[model samples]
Target: MLEAIDIHADALKRAALTAGPAARVPNCPKWTVHDLVAHIALVHCFAIGLAMNRPAKPAPPPDWEDLLGWWDGQRLALREALGQDPGSPAYSPYPGFDVTVGDWTRRMAHETAIHRLDAESALEEAPETRFSPEFANDGIDEFLTYLAPRLGRKTDIRVTTPERTWSLGEALAEVDGPADDVYRALWGRPHRASVTGDLAPVEAP
Candidate 1:
């Protein structure tokens, strides 16, 4: 699993580097490849830090002078932490669960796989990523089982794109689209493959 994580992270970095200078992430809309890379690194560190109960790290202001340094530090921190002790126990916010470092590593790898596609779209390159059916299927499962319900009920965000009714098994922010579209919509990213359903934003919880 640790090896898998390293491979995915390396792939992501390579993908980011390949992004043309003019590339703009459609999902992130306002961010360039550099910003996306930084965001990914920051998220990587944030998750690991929380799991390890590290002290809260500062989030640099967007476009701040120190942003690059901050991102580099976090990226290295995450890499070192994951490598040092992949078997350490960690707590997750999910009820009735204790996720180990191995679990987090795998999770990050799977996440990087999907996001790589979005990054690729911004780069005008083929994000045609490949992963085992086992990993992709597990990601779909985890999203349904653990992540979805956290969004709570919002009767307004109905699915109209698929022209059929469906409910999120969890993460109840409903929308109409292919399963893949649903995946992005869950993350609040827009994809042309989807048409907006009857969604109305309410106050954040």
Candidate 2:
């Protein structure tokens, strides 16, 4: 999981640098690359704080000049915090889940991955990054099983991929494609999956 986090985080940094701070992110339409970078850095810091059982001080986003460096530091801090005893008690961002470093590690990995796609979208070049089938399946399961409920999403969608199939809600709709496509679709990211029903309800929060 830590390796996944590192891979996505580094990829996100590369994409952000290529896009430039002023470039608009296609996936997160309202955000420029600068905004996207700041957001991820802040989130990383927040997760780090949680892992350490220390509340991070609320502060303005890093200046554009320092953004990447600041984010890199936070990412390292998060990795260190999460690399501690996996069973260590920690506050959970999601309710009704284990309050442990393991959960935080999983959350940060997905968070980095989803935003990594956003960074890629900010670039004019075609995004070459890809998620493996197994990784995508785990991401899909994490969203459907944990995030959807928290967001109050009632979408009943059945997702099928070459790797596996999962039922979200009551499975009123079916989306078919590769696991990565299905995973991105659930997160409202660009995907090539085929959908047989309304996808509005299944949209990520």
Candidate 3:
């Protein structure tokens, strides 16, 4: 998770730096590069506070001109917090579960990766999207296990990727695509993947 976070965060920083704060993000139509950077930085700070069980005062958004530097500091702090014991009790938005530091670590990794893609989309030529099969597979698992249940969807859905196949509930529907695309689709990103059978649209949290 830490490695994934590092890779994605670095890529995101590069994209933001290259695009400039004024550039508009294609994926997040309403946000400029500055807003995307600020959003991810704030999320990292929130995750860090959760992992360390520390209550943090809300921080004002960084100046667009200095957003990169501010994000760098927040990313460093988040990485440090994620290195702590995974089993340590931490604050989680989910109820009826004792979410741990490790949970936040994994969540933030995917979170950062997705936003990195959004940042890359702001570039003149977007970078190729790549995720290790393992990380992509786990991302699918995390979405199914941790997030889907919260949506009150009891219907079964089967998802297939080149590397593996898995199902949620009883298999009322099936989604098939490359692992990375499937992961993105599950996260509410636009994709050309095919979905068959009876299944409601996957909503982003």
Candidate 4:
């Protein structure tokens, strides 16, 4: 997961730099590249706080020009924090979930990956960057297990990918495609998958 974070963060930074701070992100309509960078930066800080058991109040990000530098520092700090014992107790942003560095590491990996796609989209880059099947499958499981039910989905749906299949509810409908596409689709990002029934159940809230 640390490796995933590093790879995605690098790609995200490259895309954000090439697109420039003011460039608007189509996927995140309300945010420009600067906003996107700050959001991810802030998320890193939040994760850092929890991992260190400090839970300090979040500091505002620097000006757009300095955002990247700030993000790099926070990223390094977060990496350090997460490098500690994965099973060590840490505060959780969500109640009732495991409060451990491992969980937060997984969350940050997905968070960075999703935003990496947004950054690449802002630059009109090709989809050359893709997650491995193993990683993508794990991401799918994380979403379905930890994030999906929060969306208040009602319909039963089966999502199938080259790497794995996930059944949410009772499998009344089906979505089939490559692992990356299915993962992105579940996150409400543009994808190339095919949906055989109403997709509202699987859409991100």
**Clash statistics: count for each candidate:** 4, 0, 1, 0
**Highest lDDT among the candidates is held by which one?**
2
lDDT per model vs. reference: 0.57, 0.85, 0.82, 0.84
lDDT of 2 by residue, 39-133 (tens): 98888999888988786864435688777777777878888999998889987656676577877788889999999999999888856778999
RMSD of each: 5.9, 1.8, 2.1, 2.0
TM-score per candidate: 0.62, 0.91, 0.90, 0.91
Clashing pairs in 2: none
* Candidate 3 vs 4: which has more lDDT: 4
Backbone clashes in model 4: 0
Q: What is the lDDT of residue 12 in candidate 2?
A: 91
lDDT of 3 by residue, 162-182 (tens): 888887666877889988888
**Which segments of model 2 are wrong by more than 4 Å?**
none
Residues 86-128 of candidate 1 have per-residue lDDT tens digits of 6788656556666667666766765666667667767665665
lDDT of 2 at 95: 66
Q: What is the alpha-carbon lDDT of model 4 when measured against the actual structure? A: 0.84
Tens-place lDDT per residue, model 4, 60-82, is 55687677778889999999999
Rank candidates, lDDT, best first: 2, 4, 3, 1
Cand. 1 TM to true fold: 0.62
